[model samples]
Target: MKEFVWAVSIICILLVFGVVLLKYLSENKKYKNSSYGKQSQKSFWKIISNQGARGEYRTSQIIDKAPFKNKMLFNCYIPNRSGDKTEIDMIMLCQKGIYVIENKNYSGWIFGNEKSKNWCETLKGKKYFFYNPIKQNRTTV
Candidate 1:
C-alpha cells in the first residue's frame, strides 16, 4: 500500500509538470510568432469577413473591365432610413438600373429557392439556415 501511494504521487507530480511545460511552450511559440507576423495578415475570423468584401470588390472590378461606357459605383453598407435601419451590402449603378447586391461568403452546399424565405447550407455536414438575400435587399430598396 505504501509503494502504491508513492507511485501515484509521483505520477501526479509528473502530470502536473507536463501540463505546465506544455502551456509554457505554447505561450512561448505564440509570443515568438507574434513578433514575426505582419499586422496586415488577417486572422481566421477576419478572413471570413473579408471574403464577402473581396467578392463585392471583385464584382465591381469585373464590371469595370467590360466595354460599358456608363458610370459604375460600388457602395458598401449603405444605411436605410427604414425603422429597422437595415444596411445594403453593395450597390452597383449601371446603364440599366441600380443593382443591390448582398454578398454572402459561406462555404457549404447551399439549398433553397429564390421564393423561399430562408435557405439552408450544409457546411462540413453541419446545417445552417440564413434569410434570403433577395428579400433582404428588397426590404432595403
Candidate 2:
C-alpha cells in the first residue's frame, strides 16, 4: 500500500511539472521560437481564422500571374453607421463591374448550400461550422 501511494504521488508531481513546463514554454515566446516551433509558425488552433489569409495569399498568387488590366483591391474595410467595420477580401474592378470574392479555406468534407445560414465542415472525426461566405460578402456590395 505504501509503495502504491509513493508511486501515485510521484506520478502526480511529474504531471504537475510537465504542465508547468508547457505553460512556461508557451508563455515565453523566445523558448518556443528557439525550439522547433514549426506548429507555432502556423495559426492558433490551425482552424479557419488565419486560413482565410492563407487562402487569399494563394489566390493572390494565381491572380497576380494572370495578365489583365483589371484592378484587384485587397482587404477593403468599410465603416458602418454603428462605427463598426465590414471587411471585404478581394474586389476586382473589370470592364463588366465590381466582382466581390470571398474565400473559405476549409478542409475535409464541406456540407452546406449557398442559401444555408451556416456551412459545416467535417475534419479529423470532428465537425466545424462557419458562416456562409456568399451571404457574408453580399454586404460588401
| Model 2 CA deviation exceeding 4 Å by range | 1-50, 80-83
Between which residue pairs do clashes occur in model 2?
none
* True-structure lDDT of candidate 2: 0.69
Over the stretch 6-120, how does candidate 2's per-residue lDDT look in tens digits?
Answer: 9999999999999988876574453233211222344423322466765765565576556765667767788755678988777778777888888777899998888999989
Q: How do the residues 70-127 of candidate 1 rate in per-residue lDDT, one tens digit apiece? A: 4443343444656555666556566778777787777779998879999998988799
- Per-prediction TM-score: 0.54, 0.59
lDDT of 1: 0.63
Off by over 4 Å in 1: 1-49, 75-81
Best by TM-score: 2
